[model samples]
Target chain A: MTTKMFDRIALIGIGLIGSSIARVIRREGLAGEIIISTRRAETLARAEELGLGDRYEQSAAEAVKDADLVIVSVPVGASGAVAKEIASSLKPGAILTDVGSTKASVIAQMEPYVPSNVHFIPGHPIAGTERSGPDAGFAELFQNRWCILTPLPGSDEAAVAKLADFWTACGSNIDTMDPNHHDMVLAIVSHLPHIIAYNIVGTADDLETVTKSEVIKYSASGFRDFTRLAASDPTMWRDVCLHNKDAILEMLARFSEDLASLQRAIRWGDGDKLFDMFTRTRAVRRSIIEAGQEVDAPDFGRIAVAKPAEASQGRD
Target chain B: MTTKMFDRIALIGIGLIGSSIARVIRREGLAGEIIISTRRAETLARAEELGLGDRYEQSAAEAVKDADLVIVSVPVGASGAVAKEIASSLKPGAILTDVGSTKASVIAQMEPYVPSNVHFIPGHPIAGTERSGPDAGFAELFQNRWCILTPLPGSDEAAVAKLADFWTACGSNIDTMDPNHHDMVLAIVSHLPHIIAYNIVGTADDLETVTKSEVIKYSASGFRDFTRLAASDPTMWRDVCLHNKDAILEMLARFSEDLASLQRAIRWGDGDKLFDMFTRTRAVRRSIIEAGQEVDAPDFGRIAVAKPAEASQGRD
Candidate 1:
């Protein structure tokens, strides 16, 4: 406890991920000093008010100076600008990383601007809540979650190890994969689901026969489940959609094609197909629960205080 | 408090809805006697083990005999058979209803067989979990939820009032709509959501680009949200799909159309369109939360014990 993981850690954005890192770093004594920088003055002031960092810098370049580690947690679309802004100030031998969802694009954006001495390891800690801002973070956001580090080939082994160890201490287990594979995997697992959630919510919102009040009133049936994902931050999701366009498009095409087939089955009243498809999906959830990637509680553990109206009752 | 809602209530299917009704009847002392019946002897035996009813009957007709109220909680496809079996055995002027999802189909199925003397009011308590069988039922299953009734024209008003009072006592607000309207409303709110969820899960499972293990491992991201709805009772949902074909197809068509537009926007990199669509949907979830139909807690109140990995971290 006497020794910190880094002499100083600079966070270049203080939203959910950055603030969570700050809170965890403070709680775990991971750094001697935390330097926070964000684009907006209001957000930076809020982070300072929350004591998220020992020092607040208006310029990301200033924040990275003398810091042993720098985490760029901005929107992926803004990664290039942030990298360019802070490139000259990054200390030699400092470990630089990002918590962007799309690794290939982030690497594409930031890798060119990185100095030769700086270790630019692209890492994504697969943990967070839907809420944003400095106040929305807690120290335990990464506990028992996976932190995937898509380090470039031939990167410094010791730097990667150090970053992995730091994330482990932050409460995440480490996994490594190719950046493209991460994009494909995340497109299916995260991007497609979020897009579908947003699309369905939009669809439900546009209905004329079904009142919005009716939709909200009776959301407990199944609609409420999608609403959670749809309620996520728009700008972040927009950046994600833009940054991971090809992968997301590929997944969306597949989803739409599969949906067309399912639509055919429903229109034709193919009960067997519907039953088999529905039955097969049940096991994925079971596997997810077994893997500890999800809660075992029915209805996301909300049934104890369930208030969803017009739920689909089970069969006899 | 001393007076029961019904002298005797016959539950002709001891699954989620039927068993929950039985449990609420016991908890609230709404019925003098509860007669549980199902197609399977094992289910009836299980219901008996759970003490969900005062007496267990293999034959629904036998169960409905001398009963003042009969609730057919079978799948929509089986409503006709259940109504036929119990029609002749129903006590004169007894109240008969159902908890089927598709009201028009259930009414069409059960109406022909119902005797004139009995009040054949079709109903659906828009409440349930993905679980099935007698053990899944809880007394609070319908608490603060909506139970919609679609009564045929010229039906006895006093009988309707009594049924409404019974559901109210069991802790559900009452909604009355035409069978066709109920189908349309539910098609968008419940049926479409379930279908889309099932389709997405199927799409994820069939992907050669992403392994099933990876999907499950990273499900806490956004995919896990859909898996809960996808894990619902296959038979019940299959029946819902088959029985509500018209409305399901209608909503599915609309959903597909919206999805196609969203797809176009994504493919074209129309950030403004995507942002606007995503922004509009956020209000629906907020409205749902304010309406008490959804958990206001982020991630469906699961973050207190969040396990989803690869979560989309918020913006800077």
Candidate 2:
């Protein structure tokens, strides 16, 4: 087992992300004692059954009393409440962070409640499956993935680095950015995708001509990818949508406008325009594959990774 | 080695879907002599280099000559042209099929050109990856996927069964549906998802406030899924949009309308409505997972085949 990074780590909200952290911390021996807390008694019970931590507490405040690090892993909308609950009990010099999808709102909700003595840093690990609850997490989930730390300006660098080192030990590459910028960036990347997936899936569900059975049957033709995204934890996504309202709205506006142009092109039979836009997007997929974000497949990320770069070069 | 189902099989076009077909066909020994053809010479050479076929031909007419089965694997727009080109040269009583995404449009485009003696069936294997070209072909790509065949009324059942058996051997479950129904169903299941993904990616690319670097960095949140869908083969998707115009437009209209309602719910802070929608959508995801269409992961198809009984239980 590895050396512990903290004497105790308190996890508030033991859902997919939180449970994952618990598993990773346990696997890597990052914390001497891990405390798991959640608002839902049932989920807390489930977390306990899963043996996710060394201690279990019904109250977030109670969980953080003696912790050297506290990680808030709740829906973005609940960050404020969680922070408010744990603020007074947090040990001075303890590092406080979160795994919320929207960083700006999380910071906004969490910053005010944090005590001046504690080192509060905001973070979001860019890794998770659509599955939720404590049972959905595993130790290897963060392997080769990114963990973004949205440290507040003037925050303690040592505290931030410690958290970064912890995540790195959990098998993630760490990067730092401003909380607001991280929120805006995520609005386009993660937020908009879920909204679009949810919107499209909902739209299909309501269609009269294309019965639900048919949609399910024929989903392999590209619709299934969106469903994967759409199938993501609704509470988490809804909270993200509500919390990151401005950035999401801005991204949605731009998306709608571009879609209109694409619609116009299709309506007018401007195949060239459609072709150019479609062609340019393919390069991005290549970059993503190179970045190890996706596998090299023809139309979706369904196929396995290519054997070697040598086998992939210039064959097509 | 597996027994070859046909003495000779001709494949037209060598894009993502087409190449995958070639890959699976070869792996399953569905054809004794795989004859590959494409409009582009470069693509044909690439297919040859990948060892995708026994014989590569630049002319569709020559490729289909004496072949026991002919598979047209081109964009929906090119179905008619390919049908016409190979009409006279196709072996009598052979099974001739096209794997275009849209059924009605493909039937309309190719039916008039097909010879009276050959069995012409429209088939779509609901399998593909985001990468294209001959290099993207893989033998196991169609494992446990769906393959829908829209055979015209009064077409030979023996021919249909033969094609079904072929795809079954290639690891796809077979389903039959009306051409028009296939178009409408696919519009929701495949076309709209691609359109939304493309539109959203294009939107993010055009944004000034959210720099491209930011978009790329935080893409793991959700936008990356859209990028994967958006990065699909442009020609194939473009043809799908144009050829399945009516069904696509109908689906798009429904999507926009539903999105408007969702937008309003968010704007008004209707948490109950949001929660209800989120809750309902969550069940749909469960059904999909049960149906084997997805895994239990929160992000992608991480647990696509988890809980086999649950996945298979939702079959129509």
Residue-wise C-alpha lDDT for candidate 2, range B185-219, written one tens digit per residue: 88888888888878887877777877776676556
What's the TM for model 1? 0.95
Cα lDDT tens digits for candidate 1, B219-306: 8788888988888889999999999999889888888899889889888889999899888877887788788776655553254443
Give the runs in model 2 whose Cα sits over 4 Å from its true position: A296-316, B1-5, B296-316
Give per-residue lDDT, candidate 1, residue A57: 97
Give lDDT: candidate 2, residue A292.
70
Candidate 1 — what's its lDDT?
0.85
**The best candidate in terms of TM-score:** 1
Candidate 1 structure quality by residue, lDDT tens digits, A16-100: 8898899899988999999999999999998888788999999999999999999999888899999999999999999999999
The candidate maximizing lDDT is: 1
